[model samples]
Target: MAVLEATNPAFEQFVRDTVLNMPAARHLGFEFGRIAPGDVEIIQPYREELTQHDGFVQGGVLGSLADFAAGCAAGTLLPPGWVNMTIDYTVKILAPAKGEKLVARGRVVKAGPVMTVAAADVYSADGAEETLCATAFVTMRNIRAARS
Candidate 1:
């Protein structure tokens, strides 16, 4: 696969701003990690409230992180002032997420004018080890945001 680079010089800032302004992302305390043209990483710190009965991170939270990460990856390839929204997504849980935090690595699979395909791998991170917990494939629709 060919490596993808960001066309927008302010892509990092754009993704940061977009994520920061989102209520769910903010509530989940999502942190920005790597931000590239066609790749992005989002980190979610573990909280008791976000865990399931067995103290593992909830599946819904994992899916949400994957969706956000994948959508942001596609958004990085969009033109300035353009944003992408998740039209559809599928996630598979492979293992229980038991760790200090979760890291989601997202990459664009294909980018087009109106739609984009992306995928993400979610990992449960301990002090120095990480375990793959989930994977997701996402489809996004690109749209120009209304200017204020």
Candidate 2:
């Protein structure tokens, strides 16, 4: 994988490719389509791969997006070799996640040595149609991985 940077001209493109390459994320069609300093946003398609038996999106799918978005947002501020892992995570479901697509928006609320705190909000794609399907808080811990 390439080292990604928030300042990179292709920040969004880089993250989009990287996120889709994640095996777990690919299984559910979670696309990391955009990024900014301390922030990330993704589009999750409402497809059979992520739907529950009753036809609504599975909670696990939403949770995964929330986690990835939060992690990536926190990642934007780190140096090479300073990758983040989800040390703690929490989510609250507020509305039915039903639509052609859903968005997961994440921001790093705080960053410190060894750990970072982040939050996310899942919303519908359509305007005036914010369901606020979910909200997430994430804890990202830096690890001593090899620099990319």
Q: Best lDDT goes to which candidate?
A: 1
Q: Tens-digit lDDT track for model 2 on 109-137?
A: 88776898999998866655667899999
- The 10-residue segment with the lowest total lDDT in model 2: 1-10
**Candidate 1 deviant stretches above 4 angstroms:** none
Q: Which residue pairs clash within candidate 2?
A: none
Listed in order, each prediction's TM-score against the native is 0.97, 0.83
The stretch of ten residues in a row with the least summed lDDT in candidate 1 is: 1-10
What's the count of clashing pairs in each model shown? 1, 0
Off by over 4 Å in 2: 1-18, 126-128
User: Which one wins on TM-score?
Assistant: 1
RMSD of 1: 0.9
Cα lDDT listed for each candidate? 0.93, 0.78
RMSD (Cα, Å) of candidate 2?
4.8
Alpha-carbon error at 88 in model 2, in Å? Answer: 0.9
Give candidate 1's whole-model lDDT: 0.93
Candidate 1 residue-wise lDDT, 1-148, digit = tens? 8877777889889989988899998899989899888999999999999998999999999999999999999988888888888999999999999899999999999999999999999999999899999999999999989899
